[model samples]
Target: MTVTESAQKPEAPANEEQPVVYKSNLEDFEREADVRLPFLLSYREVKLLGIAGVGFFLDAYDLFIINPVATMLQYRLYGGNELPANLEGFVKAGANIGSVIGQFAFGYSADYFGRKAVYGKELMLIIFATIGSICDPTGAISPSGSLIWLGVWRIILGIGIGGDYPMSASVATDRANLRRRGTLLSYIFANQGWGSFVGSLATIIVLLCYKHTMEVDGHTSKVDGVWRILVGLSLIPAFGTLYQRLTLPESTRYAEAQKAAQRVQDEESIEQLKKKANADPGVSEKTKHSSDEEGSGTQTPTVETATAESQSVKAAKELAHAKKGHFKEFFAYFSEWRHLKVLLGTCVCWFLLDIAFYGVNLNQNVVLQQMGFDGSEGTPWNRLFKIGIGNLIITALGFVPGYYATILTIEKLGRKWIQIQGFLMAALFLGILAGKFYTLNTPSFIVCFAFLQFFFNFGANTTTYCYPAEVFPTRFRASAHGMSAACGKAGAIISALAFNSLTKSIGTPAVLWIFVGCCIFGAAFTLLLPEVRDRDPDVVYEQELRERERARH
Candidate 1:
């Protein structure tokens, strides 16, 4: 009998408790609630998010480390050789291009497979690449050839950093509960601040300690070990978190999806059996015939009990199947998938925001010099140390506190509003800095620089990373984030490669204007996204789907 018929059939006595029969279609019921995973998660959730957060730390370290290292390379690696402006651009752009590739490749692959399969593998790839690049020798190489090697390995490193974006973002999204998801995700992302701060600190320590003994640019120097030490430092976080990630559970949503898919298959088989029994009387009659050869005959206790037992198993399996869909199963999320628009929009915003954010950040060194921070004029060691300290100070004053503040308040404020306001703030500051760069002296310039960095973190940087993982459905959440993050990395590449040349040719003020423009565009684009704070991930899709259905009708 169908569920409707079963539900309508009868009721038991008041004193006797009855089984709660779920008479709804499996699809309809499954849509309503996914079962919690078999294992306990509250404690494990914290551990898993921590593992992912560490990935962001390494990612931040590797990315910002380039700034200090670039200065060191300009003096040390190229042999105080004047690096042609064009070659300098290529060297910088290499890693960002690689990041774009890694993000897209790993991200799509993770979505196609399981999140657990892709999680820690990227970090290992980074470790090996870092080791290989460090081992590169300059003995037989021309300046161009050496740069090619540097760019190649940087690309390799970029891939690993790129992969971290989706893996970490999606993991946090998958593990967090609805009530505090934004808060948790922001915490995971805030590791970038520490990464930036530490990168600067590492550069400072290496430069200061090595300052007196070395020779470069016709002077005594302190930056001989700078390249090797800075690059090697990234390995610490990679090794520290690898083992912990291996032990973490695949997300409960993933587990539930897998279980749900299995149940559906089982229910279909049972339904098929019932159909065959009805179709061929000879096959079914062997058991049911005992109840009635004629209409007048009644079901015996033995026969009724057997039929009831079989029906009970079938119902239980259906219930189980409806509750947890398969994690690996690819539900056609765009066509048959109801929440495709939101996913598409979220991904696009990440791409747009990244192009602007990275373009500005990647070329910040040029801005530093334009603002009169030319380390080339001072004692080489003293110059590098000053620049490194500046990086550390800006990171501490701007990124660290802004990120922690976001983590504390995201739940109360909401993700959409925060992102919208963040983009606007970043745009506003960039505009101010662009207009003032020519007019401001050192003190005012420093203040504006600090303000721009602060507002960028306090506003857009925190939200762009947080929103993607929050918006997508569990099945494709990582993949979607990967795509968006990859788009952002593409922006990073544009910034890295072109920022120097753009500044050299067009001037620093124009470059700042470009960033300001990107920020403005980002702010305008963000207005389209739905507000998602304090909302459940599972139900968000359903709510979006319903809105579409209502529109259609």
Candidate 2:
């Protein structure tokens, strides 16, 4: 019976625990979900963020820890000679390369396979790779061999690391309500700041462990233990989330959308059956007319069709679902210029942001030295310790705070404006630093650098991560976000490989100018993105599909 018609008939027993049964109509349910997601915040949301966010925390820890780890490696492995230029570049860029692979691979997998099936597998790769990395027999191998060993395992670890980008983003975005979508995403992305802070803090604490030896021997070989410990600590958070990531239930939003897709599937199947029955020579004209009614594009599930489920039909449906809903669907959705442009914008913006972001960040030691915290004039332990202090100062004053600032302000200011102003402000600082590279005194340069860090997080860095998760439809969200993020990693890879060489060839001032150019162009691309506040990609996609159908009629 129709839900409204049955409503007046009778009531169920009050003693029984009951389903809410509010909206039998799928369209009404979708509408309510859009409103309810933002308003609904509870333990479930917190638990999800807590689990999914670990990947990001690990991401920041591993990515930044390398800074100190590399310094430690310098003393422990090379007796403080600068690492081979090629090996240093590979070590820095390797994880990012793996991230690109993981982003593309997992992004597509989550969308096609459903979030739950593919969710925790990336963590497995991370665990395996992390273990492999720490076990790199540095004492037994040649310097080149040790570097290769570390680089290789990091790349493997990176695959899992990179995969987490799309996997976590999709999981968060899929579960998030429309009202607080930006805030929810920002909370997750902000973990990177803490991850970075913890990495710095960890270095200080670990370095202190062998302070006596460091001071006595200057550049003692015992420093080998330090990098391994930092790399291994990431495993603690990784293991904490592995069980939860594996056990994650399918997203409620994704489940509801699947119901809608199945309803459409049933309507198609019933139409096909009607057409075949009518084509029989013995079939009457009335049956043919009924077939036409069935083919009239009615989307809501009818009582007969909804009840038509049987073991055999379900078996076919499952098989058909597996075969049909893959790449062609993704392609059909993005075939139009309007949709294509958004995907393009996300990719381009993220790519540009990472180019500048990584370019500036990876060169922190250079900036730290300019601020007069250089470890160059000291003993081995003192030199490494001085740079660690520099890293700690930068992380405290700028990097961590900027992310939290975006979290507080993003929902109010809207993503587009924040990204625009962030880019403009960041460009302003980089331009000042680049223009006054030689002339600026210590305090002034640090001020400009700190503000630059502030604006990157407050503006594009956090927002770029948010946009991909928000801008695309559910079925395509993971894949699109993955592609966008992978492109960003590609930018990082280029910068990692080239920045040091570029700094040497053209000079640091010229390199900062290039970053300024990247940041300014990044702002221009921000215009291509929608505000994403109060909007639901799936809800909007449904509306557009209906509008197109109406126009066709």
Candidate 3:
């Protein structure tokens, strides 16, 4: 038997004497889905994961790769001079701005339309915009103009990357078995670390390939190709996964919900028609007899025709009600304080995490400089190689391992505990860095920095993504995840735009102090979220509906 087939719960034999339990259709469907899907990874599940995960890989690559690309641009476009601080901030922040917009727009679209409708379109956007960014017209435009061109394309790329947040998270969460949902999501998110590592590795390899040619005649002309090629390589995975995303089926939960809603609408429509027919004084005996025969299929031809017409009218009314209820039901469902609190917790925690997360990520080179890996005294190629090695070491020591640790332990430790510990530990390390900024030697700094990266991934970063996807009901899961993610990106934008100037004004130590505070607050906010390990979100949603119904009565 297939995994899905083997996972199914055996049905009890029906007995005429025993009355059947009248379960709500939605609840019944949820129960069936829960039984049919298992936590074990089948070939099909892995394929789905890879296809969904490619976007996150690109997101990480496109976002972090800019660091090296920006350095290369400094050489190729500005004659080896650093970009002006303001332009540099804008260029770094452009994609984040686009991401904020995409998250809000795409999140709502996924909830309002269907997940399948919006899944792969964002990947296509990423492919197009990534190509546009790499092909920035350096020769045809002034240096500043070239920067602007790349920034514009990066923003477009950010939008697509942003869409991937909700699309992938929702798709993965919707299909995952309860026992392995967190693990599967962590697996998908772990791709971000890999993407970052690969971006660094790719830059190093490409720089080496062109180092000799660019060094000749003291001209660094070939260095320009390094960033372009790095950015261009992301397109390969994007294209490869596009067909899978486009062809993937809509989530079973969503399909079942629609069916349940239609069944309810049909029942209500038939009941209302019965009441109207009973109350009408002008109804003739013949008309009454025909109405009674509608179900039995023993009516005359004219009566049969009238019954068919009535059924069509009911169908039209049902469709209208479904359309009207779409937005109304969303607002009404979330208006309850209990539901809204989950959203608030997710958004706030994510926001707090990103402020520190992006601040450190986007400005990691500054941290590396403090460790004496700045390569200031070396040739351009030597400098690039050192930077790549530093990044690779950082990823190896911290980012990649942290993500895998979360994957291995997430199901066991519980998301809340891991997130809380991650935040507190991250804060502790940040405090160490802040207090010992100048006093610490190179090895000490690397140790602290590596620990911070490790906890950040193992803690809030992975949990934040996993929680929002799992906590919300299917009707609003995508939208809620999007809003939370968008809020996080907003924090990233603030960090990116303000970090450079903030560092200049208050020094790096003071900035590290601020990040430490953010991490603390992130941990505090995480307390507001419930621990959701191994729980089916649909089951929780059904319980909530029962409670709401009970309160009304």
For model 2, which pairs clash?
37-177, 38-177
Question: Where is the poorest 10-residue window by lDDT in model 1?
Answer: 1-10
lDDT of 2: 0.81
Model 3, runs deviating above 4 Å: 1-40, 261-323, 550-553
In candidate 1, stretches whose alpha carbon ends up further than 4 angstroms from where it belongs are: 1-46, 215-224, 261-331, 336-338, 542-553
Local error of candidate 2 at 227, Å?
1.0
RMSD over all Cα atoms, model 1: 9.4
TM-score: model 1 vs. ground truth: 0.77
* Descending-lDDT candidate ranking: 2, 3, 1
lDDT of each: 0.67, 0.81, 0.81
> How high is each candidate's TM-score?
0.77, 0.86, 0.87
Which regions of candidate 2 fall more than 4 Å away from where they truly are?
1-41, 217-219, 262-323
Candidate 3 lDDT, tens digit per residue, 489-542? 999998988888889999999998999999999999888889898666655665
**Tens digit of per-residue lDDT, candidate 1, span 489-549:** 7666666666766778998778878877777777776776677775555455444444544
Model 2, span 307-417: residue lDDT tens: 687866874575347436557667877998888989998999899999999988887888987988768887777777788888888888889889988878787789999
**Candidates 1 and 3, the one with greater TM-score:** 3
Better of 1 and 3 by lDDT: 3
